[model samples]
Target chain A: MSAPMDKPESSRRQFFNGTVRGAFLFLLGAATTLLFRRSQPKRTVWQIDPYKCICCTNCATKCVMHPSAVKCVQVYPMCGYCKLCTGYFEPEPISLDTGAENQLCPTGAIKRRQLEDPYYEYNIDEPLCIGCAKCVKGCVLFGNGSFFLQVRHDRCVNCDECAIAIACPSQAFQRVPADKPYLFKNREHQA
Target chain B: MRRMLRACLYLTLLSLPLVAAFGVERFPPPEFDAGYKMPVTTMPPARALWLSYVDVAVLVAALALASYLVLKKRSRDGVLALSVFSLLYFGFYQQGCVCSIGSVQDVALALFNSGYVVPLTTVAFFLLPLLFTLFFGRTFCSGVCPMGAMQDLVLLKPVKVPAWLEHALGTLPFVYLGAGILFAATGSLFIICEYDPFVALYRRTGSFGMLALGAAFLIVGIFVGRPYCRFLCPYGALLSLVSRFSKWGVTLSPTDCIHCQICDTACPYGAIADPMLKDPHPDPRKRARRRLALLALTALLVVLGGWLGERLSVPFSNSHATVSLAEQIAAEDAGKIKEPTDASKAFRQTGQPVEELYAEAHRVRGRFAVGSVLFGAFVGLVFGLTLISVSEPHERNVYDPDPADCVSCGRCYVYCPKEIVRVKRIQGKNVIPLTPVRGEQKG
Candidate 1:
């Protein structure tokens, strides 16, 4: 029978073997250490970067949730506060009235109120909003892009694999730290 | 066995038309109705968090079972049963989400982006298999992994890859691993998950390209034996590295090897290394000199690889949305283009200054430049090591399993005479003692 045990190693060869094994151990330890060091206490949630979002309407249908968790949020600081707000009004509204036909939001989710002379404020009704991004598209196309879509944590089921994120045409969906969830687009920075 | 072969042949014949039917479009055109009402989009009842917990429990249990079967039981049938169970549960039932293989990218991206927090479960998924491999060799690869299981099931005729070609092609997984990390770290893409061949089958819907690629991999798997796992799986490459330093590895026989050569033929992955023979050679000093020369050449290759990587970064960076946008804007500014893409139009509508966009793109490109060079250096190192290893001679005394290649499939157990003898002894049957041959040893 062949030798059941390995041949006796010379001291130099033994040293070489030890060194190689040591190197491998060192690398494995380093990787594991680095991974643990980088790990966070809490996981992040899906979010949308408004600047990267092209106002695609897939948010309305791609989600398994009816009337998707994706909701339009407004950054008030960036709002121009225009009387004829493109986001609130249709392309060819009969008048600047808050009628369902005159409004760009198909669900009449945007509540228009006269804040001041030639200025109006629009608030989104979360229950009614369908996340079509029609108003977002309008605002981005003609206004200061104050209107944007965001994943509402309360409404979101936190699917391990978010369907909207997968079907997102522009790949706007990303993970954000739960503590500071929203990826709000500030005037000073790009997404 | 002949009856089983006949049954398989009949099954194949019966399924032939069904296979051809996938190509034909059978749906008729929908007729319009004026009174047609839009179907109300109802939410499917959300799966409970408990269900997700259950999936994790199932995964852990299956992994434990697979390890036990491979290390203790050493039963091929047990391994095959576990593989089928894993395939059904993980691949078909769970629809292939939150996979350990894909979690590699998530971990990589999280490591680079401090702001991005990878899920705790994802971290568990990524590390569990690796830790298992470190202790028990590749028990995870034996049957636990759905991707491996899927490929293993379709292995009809596994042909041994030519030694030279196998050595050369083996480096691809390392390159793929490097590229996967570089892209994920730079926030460019997730090539590993994105190019996953089997995920589409699990999900039941995907791009035509991915579906075709999946079909192709399966067809090649019939003869090539888990092509993706062998040549393209980044996670497999990582597992192989850890398995190299595993505390324990697979043994072919229960008692002693009779050198029957049956187990060698049984291993589908070609992971069995024969007992070593003494080399009749002279000039040890010359061999050392040649190894030194190869080491120097390896260093030179690394430098060249890093340089080439940096040089190609500009075009490579275009895969990033911001970089592509900047290029388009630059072209537009120079009056070289007139058309505006949907993204470009959206960018314009956002009213962000073009300078800021360019700056972000430039930063992203700079990150890619650094990442790609590192990626190239990593690939070069792997290539050099592969080159060195292929020529390295082994002095193994017994016909042992190659730690880096063996998946602990347990097929060897079926053909081992010692294993058969042990089983017969357990069953209380008459057995014959056979002496192992020494002179008939190959090499």
Candidate 2:
């Protein structure tokens, strides 16, 4: 069979394609420049504003990663080092001791060591902490609010939209600079 | 045991609480006689900023390589190899965060919300594939998109879907795209990222429902080829639109068409377009009349669809958290619900005015009303165009790849006898007798 020739139509199609392609290229270029101009110079990562956080414990369950990246961090300067630390002990504890049952932390993450007479240092076992924020509630309400939840950079996969942030009722999540990922109670007080 | 002891010792050494005494100190820290050094609170460094630039570089390289493999080499093996690498790097290693598929929301949010700034990496991820597709049809889908790669690898037994069903299901991605953009624009939610099916599989940790959804897609993919790519991927929908005007794309045969009909069955996506012979007798008047009628119908559909979408605004706006919170608070006040939900209780604790919450929700609802109408009109336009295109007669006289649907997988190359002959000639092997064309006598 002889090849069907449509030279005029072919030329018209080529011109149309060229025009459309050029328009699309221009549109893409404009969009890219606009977005680039609006983009922040410093990359930001997900963080929890300690003051806004109501310690609802959603961080434990709502994180995409099991065990959650939101770990309870202790701001040492702000801590009172009270012997009867509310963050380490449950309400109406049987005894003011480091017993698993008396500890407010679900995973026994809080380790209480005697620093001196009537002063006990509470350290968080980062691996054992499940980010429940149960202790945060106790600390914020009953004692110095030294204990606060922070998204640990090492563990966080840093999802574009944090699952915990969506679930937070208080709208506590904020995008902090990557270099200063943690939002500490002490630092906020200092500022 | 020694490691545990060391850790405990390290914890003690790091636990020196200095009495800066900034906050309300209910209980004062005990003073120590010995000079005890205060250890600063340590923070793990964030993922290096430079690494994100590396991801962009890798993405650019992959897109370039994919276009070369699909067009220049026309090697299926090369495409498969590249796709596997994409699956490992983009899917598992990166854990599927900030992907092009999910970046749609970021771009939308950036455009609509001035407060929200999209990262540079995300913008690169969002725009690169479209730029590549505009020049060389959907090479991103062929080998670079991790989601497509995952589905492609799982496709073992390909089942051909009926044309009508395929066309019906094909509208889903457009709807999904519309909703995703709407939600993102309103700053309500990133539904696209929230419901991503493969992210859980990539991370190996997510909600049970997401895992189940991913599993279902994979199981369905075993029989169907790239189910998500064809029917659900919003990014794929965008790419297809751009691919229609691609400058260069995969070709079935190296030389002129010999009408072998082998490549017809070779493409799992059914992207091959068969030759169409011109009718011996034509009626130009009837064709013109039908086209005009269809155009009128399309215009009518756009109006009707927009009206229907306005009616749906109330239901769609409920998906926004603020609107739902307001409704919940209102319900509790009306004695519809005896107990307040956690969210409502939290709102009450904030001591914010109830009227303010309602006002915010009303604003959100108003935005949704406008957004939904536009979304519906777009959907209507796409459906009407599809109908018109389906009714039009094909004018092609040669077997070719459907530009919009062909993903440049390069699978059809091996099916062409002419391609095999070319390969053999390059290998310096004995030439086989050329197959005679149908209805033409061989010498």
Candidate 3:
């Protein structure tokens, strides 16, 4: 034998190792089953807390869908109702016309309607929106931060792991329960 | 043992009521106004209580099959089939979350975060394989692990890394495990799961950088043969350490070794040890004396490493979100940063006390300091062991698999002549005892 071939000592070590392994397994098994039982009703849906979003333009590219499910939503109460809406019009628009060149949304998802004289109401066309967050950034910077991104559940495949959540830079994506999924940035939202 | 089991049962029972009490609360009211017609809500499919149990059952079955194939059957083909199944179920079907590899972080996080209740699946994923490995010598690694399976499938051009280079590179897993625990314990991130290469492939979507990293690992695996498992998998490091004392293990042959060297080249992972009967070094007594001194030095290094780690904990603590936020708030206060980012803005709007945030950061940093000392000691211990194992080479009279390194892939069985004879004997064929042929005996 290369080393001491004490059978009793070797057997003792094996017994000790086996005991430790058994004890660990038993404890882990208990904890695991408890956790599983506890997690039964805990279903989570992917969502964005608009207040935490950094508008990094990742929502457009990182989403698995060709046209991202994330869409820009207008918080009407938070809107300043500006006639020269920074979100609807380009940064250096020649005029606030209905021309494509003057439109801020790359896909023309934001529709500018004159509610009254010197005030325009902007509504997001969800189907046309790519969630690039360009308008959200523009609005947040220059106007009342009314425009924000939210995951459109209608189009979402509900993947086990959200693609955009993994890529989100500011870690804005969260898993809120299915019942109250959207963390909308509204007038009531403190932040 | 009975007492322990009873205590565990009681504890689990006691915790159930608490779990139910804090169970899913009422969902908050709708964000939109009464006049606004909410879009039809598409909830994630209700996770049935039985579904999680099904996953657990599948996992248990797979482990059982893997152990059977590896230890009893010794069929590489069976192992491969299991690997393919694991790749399909665990990798593609489940999308690689709650994996044994990722569970390392969950366990670490739970240990540190007393309030954090680890998901049951995470605990199961972490332990079952380790338990199997302790008994059956890394049977889980052979085929059951989706990460290993993915890499195994891509092994096209196998190459033998130089022994010294392999030894040096093998140290990386320990460092990786230490860093993983450090990050998780500090609530910095689950870097292991975040960087898991095969997970992106399973999901069929992720950032370009992560996708590229996954592709790069697979490409490297074509030549390196489970390079991630050997050099980067923190879980693999844990398995390897525990597998050293495995009760049952793989053998190169069923019977005596004929000193044939074919099996030596068979193992892609370089787990086979080529025995040398003679002492390679002169002055055995002197070497023994030197070894004792080295052991003392290793002990010293462990203590010194812990001290150094404690000193460096502050910088390491920056990875934690609270610490980073605190530093950012301080920077903004000092007018060092011109503009506040979204996180800072959100924090300011929360109306939470800045002093409380600072205290939280301080507390996290203090924990990191303690965590770092343990991490440092672990690293130093690994370093000392590596040096000592190399210095005190064991005498081996026959070719054998190194228990610590062997993944039990069963590649060596086919190369062994005795194993071939045993197979023939089992199949009711005439078994011939080895007698040297005239030409072969000339040497």
Residue-wise lDDT of candidate 1 within B192-249, one digit each (tens)? 8778899878766666666788999999999997899888889999988877767566
lDDT of each: 0.73, 0.82, 0.75
Q: How many angstroms is residue B166 displaced in model 1 relative to the true structure, after the best TM-score fit?
A: 1.4
Q: For model 2, how does the per-residue alpha-carbon lDDT over B64-148 read when each residue is reduced to its tens digit?
A: 9999888877789999999999999999998887699989998998998788888999999999999999999999998999999
| Candidate 2 Cα errors over 4 Å, as ranges | A1-9, A81-84, A94-101, A113-119, A187-191, B1-24, B32-40, B276-293, B331-338, B341-355, B426-430, B433-443
Q: How many backbone clashes does candidate 1 have?
A: 0
Query: Which one wins on DockQ?
Result: 2
The list of candidate 1 runs beyond 4 A from truth reads A1-191, B1-47, B254-256, B280-282, B426-430, B433-443
Indicate whether candidate 1 or candidate 2 has the larger DockQ. 2
1 against 3, candidate with superior TM-score: 3
Chain B TM-score, model 1, reads 0.86
State interface RMSD in Å for all models.
Answer: 18.8, 7.5, 15.4
Better of 1 and 2 by lDDT: 2
Give lDDT tens digits, candidate 2, residues A6-106. Answer: 22337778788888888999999999998998797798899998877778889999998877988999878777777767788887689888888898999
Choose the strongest candidate by lDDT: 2
The second chain of candidate 3 has a TM-score of 0.87
Ranking by DockQ: 2, 3, 1
lDDT of candidate 3 vs native? 0.75
**lDDT of candidate 1 over A46-73, digit per residue (tens):** 7888867877688887764567878887
